[model samples]
Target chain A: MVPVDYYIILSAVLFTIGALGVLIRRNPLIIFMSIELMLNAANLAFVAFSRMYDSFNGQIFVFFVIAVAAAEVAVGLALIVEIFKTKKNINIDEMNSLKG
Target chain B: MTQTDFYTILPLTVLAVWACLLLLADLFIPKDRKGITAFLSALGLAVTLGLTITQVGRENLGFNNMVVVDGFSTFINIILLASSLFGVALAYGYIKRMGLERGEYYTLMLFSVTGMMLMAQAADLIIVFLALELLSIPLYVLAAFARPNLQSEEAGVKYFLLGAFSTGFVVYGTALIYGATGTTSLGGIFFAASNGTPGLLLTIGAALLLVGFGFKVAAVPFHMWTPDVYQGSPTAVTAFMSSGAKIAGFAALLRVFASAFPSISVDITAVIWVLAALTMIVGNITAISQTNIKRMLAYSSIAHAGYILMAFVPYGNKEVMPVSVAAGLFYLVSYAVTNFGAWAVVISLEKAEGKGLEISDFAGLAKKYPALAIAMTVFMLSFIGFPPTLGLVGKFYLFRAVIAGGYTGLALIGVVTSLVSAYYYLRVVINMYMREGDPTIEREQWLDFTTVTTAVATVALSFVPQWLFFMASTAALRLF
Candidate 1:
């Protein structure tokens, strides 16, 4: 049986990678994928905790989170498509002229 | 399982039902009748605002301590809903002009309001994260709702990316704290914190969570996205994000710190103090250099966030928490009204067909649109903390609270930065009255009416802040 700490550490690593991807990547799609990765990391932690404690509350929360993440992905992808149509480029740095 | 639970969630339920109805209603309504959705949203928001006021002093936990309905939540809820009402009114004509007058816009706005209300009431960390997403997802779409505008699209993408980045921090932090404490309940965390373990995991978790919220509120170091996103989004959406979203962020921060991590939060008090000071200085200084109206206001929003952070200086188990809550609450109301008025001026004068927001474009507005120029002047003055305005009263009360709490240095920084803010604020006035140029813009009748109504209320409220201050004082009392 694996120690609970091992699961916790693994999830943290995945979350950090997702954060780094979100910061470093310019493509809206990739940034979005990073966000999904982060959410999955959170779900993984939730499932781990539920299994550790033998409680249903953490699993119930994971269900709601999955629902909300689905909605977020649909809306986020639609927004990215709209931006791509207008800007014709997904480079994050190219969008910096909006300052005063 | 009492009647208060029903009463507590009554306003939230009202908003949800109205949003669903509006979503379905939009499918059948003609294109031109989009104004009806705005009107209905305004009415629904107003009704909820009234309902929230009825639950002001009632302190009850709904859904097993997951949701708290109390004075603090009610106060911020009123501010959010009031601003949303103003936003719907402000957006109605702008949407028609831009040809983005769809029901989705109104529905998204309604959904965002639901999220904000939830943010204020959430007692559990899990609920807070859910509420944050609920608040953010709609805003990301709204930011890019301008289909063909490249800047708008870019703003949406940037906000989405950064927003998602911050969410990761919050959730990971939450997971760590849950791991250490074995529960996600706010009360459970507080109980654990009281034991004074201050585990490394809990400390890192709390810091990461602050980073996430700090980004949301647009504080100094985490505020990189604010000016860009504000400048790119539509003017009305910018106004909503500035007022409504900032309120939610502060409310959530207060809950997490005040309730969840009170033990080790003392170690963090110095860091918050420093952030507050830096946010004030950086925001005001950057705002002074801005040539565009929206971008300047964005920076101004950052400065106001700094002021809200001052409330946190007195937050951690101090005798001054009540005063801090009062100051934060009052400032929120003042910002909601004043910022809405500023955006109302922008929406009114912008070209009926396209962009007309260069600060130079407002030259000689005093001569052409005296009413609007006067309104803008009032908002700027209130924002700068001029006497006889609610802004002045709010700032006065806020700094008094700070000084009473023995943070005279922080109070002094607030005063100096506010004075610095006045220079740029007055630049708008100087252009309107002192400079010479032509006002070539024509306003639509509805937009014209909105400008007049907002101007009148701003001036009228500036004169009689007693009513507002009285309500705020009572609301502050209810928090304790």
Candidate 2:
């Protein structure tokens, strides 16, 4: 069996990449995907830790996180559709109408 | 869940059910009769408030200790319900006037309040995460409630994106904490920390949690989304988010830190002290330049978060935790009442399609509506922490608690920034009385009533604050 440290490191790396994608991406679609990646990374870490600790709590938490991520994706896509309908673009940079 | 668990969460359960019922009832009701939903929502909140009041001072752990019923949660719940009532009242006029009236507006607000109430009662990290989402998802929708409007849509997307990012931080942090401590319960974490020095993973996790909460409360460095979201959302939604979501955020913050991380406070307190100072300086200084009233208040709200964070800076001190926490709670109540009142006045003066919201639009308000002008002046006075208003007493307690906790330097920063805040808060007063313009009002009876009552209460309550102060202190005592 694989060691838990390897899984945790992979999860942390994935989380960092996802966070960077969110920071660097201009498209709302990609940003949403990045957020999903981040959530899944947390899910991965939870699963890894659960196995190491022989505890079901972390696994249960992962299930809840997955469920929440699905809901978040649904809402995020709906908002993106709403924005695209009016502005005809999904770029965050172009969606700056409410400024100081 | 047992019968005891159901009873422990009676108010939250009632509110959630009522909100869903309102959503279904809206489908059958005609478009012209949306006011019924608002009235029904307010009635539900009033009943839930009563239920919550009955449970006050009765501490219980239910749902296997995932939920807590105690003085702290009850006090915060009362503030949440009262703020929602004002939110609905203010929304009634603003939504109708702007032709944005929808039953979902009230329903979503009720749902959001339920989330907030749940946050106050959350005893586990998982519950905190769930409650955060429950509170926020509705707000993201409410921010974009004025759909087809480009600004509103933009606000919704921005808030959603950044808000989701913050949630990621919270989740990852929770995972790390669980990794370090092997438990997600607050009590479990406390036991783990008290046993030995927490590992690097736990400290990093705690920092990430602070970042997540800092974003929620609009503290500086994470406040980039606040002004835009507040300015673009419907004024009523903005009002609710500013007061309700903020109080919930602080409730979760205070509870988690006080209970779960007392042993780790030395490290986190330094980070919090800097956050408090930076938020106060940036929030106040930036608010001075905003012409948009919504944006100005957004910054003011951020500055107020800094003041509340001042109380948390001394959380490590065993002797001062209760006083500091109580001061933070009292300040939240004072800010909620005065903020809702200020926003009510703004809602009354707001025109269709979000016009007439500029600070200059308030010119000559005194000449047009003497009563409104006086109310706005009182709100402004409260925001500036002037004497004879609740804001002054709240700030006095906050500063005193900070000083008692031996964070006198942070307290000095609070005082100076508050003094700096006076220039902007009073600027609204100056615009209302000293300048001249044809300012008009929407003439909504509900909104006017909210404004007048909150204003009067803001002043009247200051004279007899002992009861509220005692209640808040007792609430904080339970946590300690």
- The top-ranked prediction according to TM-score is 2
- For every model shown, the clashing-pair count is 0, 0
Error of 1 at B179 (Å): 1.8
Candidate 2: where is the Cα deviation over 4 Å? none
lDDT of 2 by residue, B238-354 (tens): 999999999999999999999999988989999999999999999999999999999999999999999999989999898999999999999999999999999999998888888
Write candidate 1's Cα lDDT for B1-480 as tens digits: 777667768899899898999899888888878778788878888888888878877788887888888877887887888788878877888888777888788899999999999999988888899899999999999998776887888788789878887887888788777766777888888898778677988888888888899999999999999988998888778888888899899889987887788788676788889999999999999998898888888999999999989988877646787767777777887777788888888887677433668777788999987877888898899889986566887788889888887899999999999999999999999999988988765466655666666556656776776777667666666544
Cα deviation at B290, candidate 2, in Å, is 0.6
TM-score of 1: 0.94
**lDDT score for residue A83 of model 2:** 88
- Candidate 1: Cα lDDT at B116: 94
The superposed Cα distance between candidate 2 and the true structure at residue B328, in angstroms, equals: 0.2
